[model samples]
Target: MATVIHPTAIVEPGAQLGADCEIMAYAVVTKHCVLGDRVAVHPFAVIGGDPQYLKFDRASATGVTVGAGTVLREHVTINRSIYPGKATAIGENCFFMSGSHAAHDCEVGNHVVLANAALLAGHVGVGDHTFFGGGAAVHQFCRIGESVMVAGHASITRDVPHFTMVAERDDVIGFNAVGLRRRGFARAAIAELKTAFHEVYFTPGNIRDVAAARRAAGAFDSAEAKRFLDFFAGGKRGFARARRAEAEAGE
Candidate 1:
């Protein structure tokens, strides 16, 4: 299939566009941008802009790469990485709704959805199948896990574990049960995840230490449970804590 670039759109020299890409009117794909097959850049969207860093050198030969089948809507901006040969990468089949922004050096995984006005700060890492609701904003360098749901207008300042739901101010409400179901997770797996979630969050001292101990003790059998536990192993920003009242009520 042929790629289409609107007459008014600007795809600068050195930009790489795969087949079937549609660059809408007034969209700007800079020289360092690379877009994969079937990628759609909506009107007024900008990719490969320089990083927002104060100390960034404009001469850094960085890039922004959008993977296959990704849709970047109007007014969306994905900034290039700050280091040479590095890229701000958006993975395959991801959707960024209008006005969403992904700052410099972000590593976004496949099948992610960023709703309107959702913002990912510089150097943030997001795992696959995650959903950020409208107006949600993740802090810089935070690691958000796979299949997590970040509620609308939430301010996430810490790492969120896999399959959890975060809302308001860094509050981990609970496991993302509905999302797990929609993703075709087995009932047994969901149940195991629930147990692991409770054990790790409720009985926790230092959350990372608790999760590591549980993992070492072989307390969880299911892959879902293991993944949930493993997520706590890293991230310097610390994990989002579950609300005490909600945890007490077992919500």
Candidate 2:
């Protein structure tokens, strides 16, 4: 299939576009930018522009690279690196909805979906198959794990674990049961995840205490349980704690 570029679009020299790409009107593909096969650049979307870094040097060359089959919707802005010569990348099969923004130096993984108005700060790392709901924002340098689902309007200042459903401000309500179900997780697996979830959040003891109990009680043997534990253990900004009021009310 032939690539299609609107008359009003400007694809700068040295930009590499793969087969079947479509660059819509008013879209700009800057120098050194690379777009993979079947990538779609919607109207008014800007790719491979100068980074928004304060220390950016105009003389230095840098660019953005979009992976295969990725779609950049209308009004999306993806910036390139600012540090002399570097690259900001979006992985294969990713989708950025309208008005979404991916700042410089960020790495987005395969099959990730950023809903409309979702914003990623500079240097953030989004894991594969993750889904960010509309208006969700991740702080700079935050790491989001695979298969995670962030609720709409959620503000994440820290790392989010794999397969978790996080919502509200500073709280992880529960596992992503619905997401897992849709992804074909078995009933036994969901049951194990539920048990691990209770141990991690609803237990009477601290996180460490609950983790230790899980290990001793054979809960850590399951793959899902292991992921849950390892995620919290590796947390830098610390995972959200269960609400004290809810815990007390349950008691």
Question: Which candidate tops lDDT?
Answer: 1
lDDT of 2 by residue, 105-163 (tens): 99999999999999999988888888999999988878788778888988988777666
- Clashing residue pairs in candidate 1 are none
* Total residue pair clashes for candidate 2: 0
Name every residue pair that clashes in candidate 2. Answer: none
Q: For model 2, where is the 10-residue window of minimal lDDT?
A: 242-251
Q: For residues 116-233, what per-residue lDDT tens digits would candidate 1 score against the true structure?
A: 9999999999999999999999999999999999999999999999998889999998888889899999999999998888888888488899999999999878998999999998
* Per-model root-mean-square deviation over C-alphas: 1.3, 3.3
Q: Any runs in candidate 1 off by more than 4 Å, and if so which?
A: 247-251
Top candidate by TM-score: 1
lDDT of 2 at 47: 96
TM-score of each: 0.97, 0.85
Clash numbers, per candidate? 0, 0
How does candidate 1 score on lDDT?
0.94
